[model samples]
Target: MLDAHLTTQLKAYLEKVTQPIEIVASLDGSAKSAELNELLEEIAALSERISLVRRDDNERRPSFAINRVGSDVGVRFAGIPMGHEFTSLVLALLQVGGHPSKTAADVIEQVKNIEGDYHFETYFSLSCQNCPDVVQALNLMSVLNPNIQHVAIDGALYQDEVDARQVMSVPTVYLNGEVFGQGRMSLEQVLAKLDTGAGAREAEKLKNKEAFDMLVVGGGPAGSAAAIYAARKGIRTGVAAERFGGQVLDTMAIENFISIGYTEGPKLATALEQHVKDYDVDVMNLQRAERLLPAAESGGLIEVQLANGATLKSKTVILSTGARWRQMGVPGEDQYRNKGVAYCPHCDGPLFKGKRVAVIGGGNSGVEAAIDLAGITSHVTLIEFDSKLRADEVLQRKLHSLPNVDIIVSAQSTEVLGDGQKVNGLVYEDRVNGEVRRVELEGIFVQIGLLPNTEWLKGTLELSPRGEIVIDERGRTSLPGVFAAGDATTVPYKQIVIAMGAGSTAALSAFDHLMRLPVAAKPELVAA
Candidate 1:
């Protein structure tokens, strides 16, 4: 609801105005187009009135401006702009009605010359105060040029995707597919990126880079390390990832990883990604390699055919494709994932400190989580569908000794209970007695089994019986110039330090492979 004062002001303003007004009741239903239509109608009317009022006020110029450079300004809206930002919205609308400000005019001039379609996604929650200004700015830009496609995603409406993206704040702007800039950006800053035309084109060109010193597949720990090392060594390193950070970003916390004692998955991934950025490393975040063919023209260049119809050529390939956690396959599992339910205990356990929580599955991860949660929380219920805990006796003894921990044997989780916003508790049924009961708790942790993310590399690389990548002693794979490491590979002990060490090893080996090749290339490297 709007404040009474502003409502009164708006009502007064509306009563005096004869402009065609259409209120957007919700942030849905062709909002961009509708708002745009309304804005155009208002601007056109203002244009007509400007000539009549301009004779007396010579200093006051008319509103509205257009760019001749690219096509559009491309404003991406994220949330509903009401409340305090409403004023900002009105100002923006007024600016849109009048001539474009110097900054907006310059941006329009720059965007008019752009060749490709610029897709911008703005993420916002309803509670955000400054989001309306961003939405208005993007809408204005979209109206300025038809080439700009602005997408406003209401975080309140899509909480699941918000959580999945690990969006901690509102008004995050994504240019193209990568993060362009965060928070409220000045119109000039937005124009600078548009004028450069480098960031967006780099990813597209990477798809066609025929020859690289190092080709790092996947965007997990090992592959990132390998790519960073190779790039730092001045080797042309290209990383083809289905998604940047792979499975590592899905984790909530990584306590066991050495040096970085307690860090969120996305934070760690971001740190590594930042490191990769420090050098010239070509990272394809959302690109998937479809096939690996040995170079036909010699020089050890491996042609990596991508599913996106782009080919990546490299001298050495490092495969660090990691594994994923097995889901319970229960209904609402996907919807509730990362909301109230989670797969990685180490990442998200601290969120439930001093609260009662439940752990599903009695494997090593489950036992470890139960024991770990015991240190912070008061009560932890371990529900196992199997007859017994599959962890070692030492862990089992530790879990049994904890007074707050309860082990429910042969119990299966039927459904995750929550308010469709966040996890509040869970429901389980005893396999033996067939009795179902609801448990009230703060959160539920799922740690069933690990599933390798190697489906894409099935025919290309040799996989173990468990679906993990098969690697030699030095992280070398069955194929020449290809190596594997981390949890995705044959290395045992799926610990953070182990993965890190394995990644380091694969990186060094990949560097060695690249060094063994002919002419030296000092590739620029960046961490991803």
Candidate 2:
């Protein structure tokens, strides 16, 4: 079950169904199958137009086929639709119940005109917040065209298939038995891959010597802001990123972005990309910067070599490469990463609602996560490696005020304890007593410090001891014509608002540097 509020919302949403929709579930009386059947029955009870039909088919025991009353659009889900993916089931029902899709006209037309039979097998985890987007997109495409079929496979339930495919991550899409992608992908990106024979063109190189006046080397909130600010100056601006939404994509709920009372990471990321597209910023996705080199000619250009064997020359480069969460390097951590071990509390916390969970690390982030989870989960256990928590006094006071939170100091996490399916407990050492203990919990949230993505700039730019790029107040790096911002720099705090402000400052500094250059040395302004 859904809560009262969520049930009311789903009821209202399901009331719009004008045509009958049937959910045919194949079950074999297994535990997961029983859970899935109950979920389907509960959902089907919401509307008079919806019905659930259970078949005792051992071959596809845990699979469900969604079919419209009059049509034979093949859409199947082979897992329990819980957690964030519950939205996918609802959307699929609405799509099958005679509601027109909200996809773009061009995209719908393209989907309708596909020639060959394309089978998309999208492997996903229930806890993954980003998997629903890809699943919904593929399901919609399948509904639009009979030639295109999509099967949503739960990576946890079907371990044999997942291991056979070597799927180490959630949302691993396979097209015609080959790996298409590994993470969140947009509908347009998937369409592009379908158009071209290549699965997903994530690392394609530039065709010619692309140039820009201001080039941003990331695509998080910082890089998006920098590109928008630079484009406002009516100069040639370009942004290269491994993905359009850096760490933001991995995040879940984002309530700290000022003025925006509530929003999710993927929603904010989509808005950021749309805002950047509104300007003249040349965005190159799936391009990773490998090496940074100054041009042979003095005061000429900076060359950014990409992993795809393409080089980009720019007058100024703003480094906004974000940081990644530090891992505990414990056993079973990698094996059950998306299953029960998660780095993002905002993203995966809801999956453990009303269940016991533990937060690793007692700093600001760990305390914040514990506070946030206390209201949702049944219990919160905060474990710290240090003698005392390093969080601010205000945060500590607030954390202590919660009744459901328990703190353990000087506890060194040794290993993650999990069954072959998912995490069940955690093992840690009591530093003060020199004893090892296991804490029984269903989920573990790691809120350790971040590791800057500045390994490529080690010898090129001056970095701090923690490998963060050193930058002045004006965002200027030690190397001339190079600037750094956001988590990749020596910034004190790594917040979204702070990163956006830093990005704006870096863009202004680059503009000021360009304005001071001689007429011959200045970059040419291309028409927007």
Candidate 3:
């Protein structure tokens, strides 16, 4: 089932495996088992260093054990490793096959020192872009410490366990049968959790209490870029975010970030954080900004109230909270979310390659997603609620040029259909004929619109009708010292390159604002 291009890439990657790795597949008489067996066989054929063994086990059918040729690291997968989980499989094989772990030395030391017997059960969805990082981290840690065992579970395949655990989101990790984390977590964070035997709540306490000259809110590409730029100017820079990556974590492939030809969302996010850390930016993760109080007087300090009951003082604030994909809110949409219903095509499209898929909405995003998926997926059905598509003429024409794409207009998506496991089809209403129809497909991509992350700024900052913060050419808001960038602003297009540029503009504007202040009134620059 591997494409020629992907096959080549796999061969090159597998060449780095110095030690032999074995994949022991426990199979039952099920289609999911067959699919996984086929995938494993294909991967094994890529290199002689890898081997696949099958066993007819009834208890854990469709599960697999990944073992180094001689050493057993106790790494296992309870479901088909497709979508984002596919990366986990690749990385696990590499790690077990003698590839050195990339985790930092400090984190490795912490993992080595972890005392008690801990079994990490990470429940993830095939479509979740952030799941692989958490899974891979745990898997690597398991290899490093014999006391730690890691089991990666596909939530879609194990609905019973998911329901029992009340797992509402992907990348939900459990340590010793208790909730550990809900989203993407760095190795340091995981180690800290293991060391402290506490959850993220313990780490939310604000450490740096001093004032900052430039405080960038949000930690997406824009905010990270702004923080980096501001810190380079030798100013007191700080960044506060609920999570570092923001919506970038949900994104999959990124080929449009100028100069960089190819990269993934997680890779870019790591680079963004590292770049910010390279400077003196005070990064406060897991901290949400609840309220923003503009300075009463020009050049006065601004107060930012966080959800954790911590108030931060800053000379200037740049808002770059970014935006999230709009949901359909149809029946089964939420229930089967991340199962087969996904919001990001770039992240999950590869999982559905050679499978039938449907795209909701016919705007630029939807049409573009359809066009992009047509190259990987066997076929794509684009559904539009209006009589005609709302995408740009150029994009519509480009979409029509694809042979594997079908356009359906005047159609309203009514519900997502699943077989209690994963998405199997989508139900839509034919508005023109008043008929409801179900399209047989394995996945559904929703691309209706993006809701900016400026809801908290409502009634405080000057906002547009669409709830985006109103900004001038210099990325300045109506408030003198406050600025905004990225999708949270009135920018026309929402792209990574555009957001980075906007971030730089906002940082420059903030710096300009800071430079105009009197030396006695300016906040002292503290070395990060």
Better of 1 and 3 by TM-score: 3
lDDT of 2 by residue, 269-366 (tens): 88998999999888887678999986444348888988767778899899999999999898988877866787777555655667799999899889
lDDT of 3 by residue, 291-410 (tens): 988888423689888875777889999999999888898999988886778777765565565789999989988998999889988999999999999999999999999999999999
User: lDDT value for candidate 1?
Assistant: 0.65
Identify the candidate with maximal TM-score: 2
Off by over 4 Å in 1: 1-204, 295-300, 330-358, 363-381, 390-406, 412-445, 515-528
- What are the lDDT figures for the candidates, one per model? 0.65, 0.85, 0.84
Q: TM-score of the candidate numbered 3? A: 0.72
Question: Which residue ranges in model 3 land beyond 4 Å of their true spot?
Answer: 1-74, 77-129, 144-147, 152-208, 297-300, 329-336, 346-357, 371-381, 391-406, 414-443, 521-528
Give the per-residue Cα lDDT of candidate 2 at 64.
94
lDDT assessment of candidate 2: 0.85
RMSD of 2: 6.4
Candidate 1 residue-wise lDDT, 42-127, digit = tens: 43343332111112121111112222223333232234444333554454434333434434354566656566777777765443
